[model samples]
Target: MFYTYILASQRNGTLYTGSTDDLAKRVFEHKEKARAGFTAKYGVDKLVWFEAFEERENAFRRERRIKEWRRAWKLRLIEETNTDWRDLYDDLNNLLSY
Candidate 1:
């Protein structure tokens, strides 16, 4: 499965949109600052929202669309799903079977 995800620094702070095949792993990498890029530079590691796609093309398309959206729109989207703007990494980590 592929995924389109959004990472945010804070409730109305910086936003990043990207597509990846491994949602959990990608998000983990971002949090760990494993990759050097915009995410690491801006400290945008909180997984605000994400959508899974059956195809990579669809995931990419969705990611591009989200990237083009205004900051207000993106924040609204995140707020709709994650009202508290909490770090979703723990939730994803719990999904693992140890």
Candidate 2:
């Protein structure tokens, strides 16, 4: 599966939107600051939201759309799905069972 995900530094904080074939691995890398870029520099590594897709194309498209949205719109999207804005990364282990 593919996924479109959002990572935030905190509730309504620095936000990032991206698509990946492996959500768990990508979020883990961000949390670890494995690469030197926006996520690391801005400390936006808390997985806040994600949606799975059957195809990569759809995931990428959704990611692009989300990225283009205004900050308020994006915040609403996140709040609608994750009202508490929890760090979804903490739940990844249970989701993956690995």
Candidate 3:
């Protein structure tokens, strides 16, 4: 599966959107600050929202579209699924472990 995901520094804080085939590993990299980039610099490491696609192209396309969305739109998207802005990384890892 491919994934489009959003990470935030905290509730109503900095946000980032990305797509990857390995969602868990990619989010882990961000959380650990594995690379010095926007996410690392801005401390956006919490997985607030994500969507999976059966095709890589679809995931990438979704990510690009989300990247163009206004901040309010993105925030609304997150809040729709995650009203408390909880970190979803742990749940993702747990699911993958099974």
Cα lDDT listed for each candidate: 0.88, 0.91, 0.95
lDDT of 2: 0.91
Maximum-lDDT candidate: 3
Q: Candidate 1, which segments miss by more than 4 Å at Cα?
A: 93-98
1-98: candidate 2 lDDT, tens digit per residue: 89999999999899999999998989999989999999999999988888888899999999999989999999999998799999988897686553
Off by over 4 Å in 2: 95-98
Q: Count the backbone clashes (under 3 Å) in each candidate.
A: 0, 0, 0
Error of 3 at 60 (Å): 0.4
Name every residue pair that clashes in candidate 2: none
Quote model 1's TM-score: 0.90
Quote each prediction's TM-score: 0.90, 0.93, 0.94
- Position 66, candidate 1: lDDT: 88
Error of 3 at 98 (Å): 10
Total residue pair clashes for candidate 3: 0
TM-score, model 3 to reference:
0.94
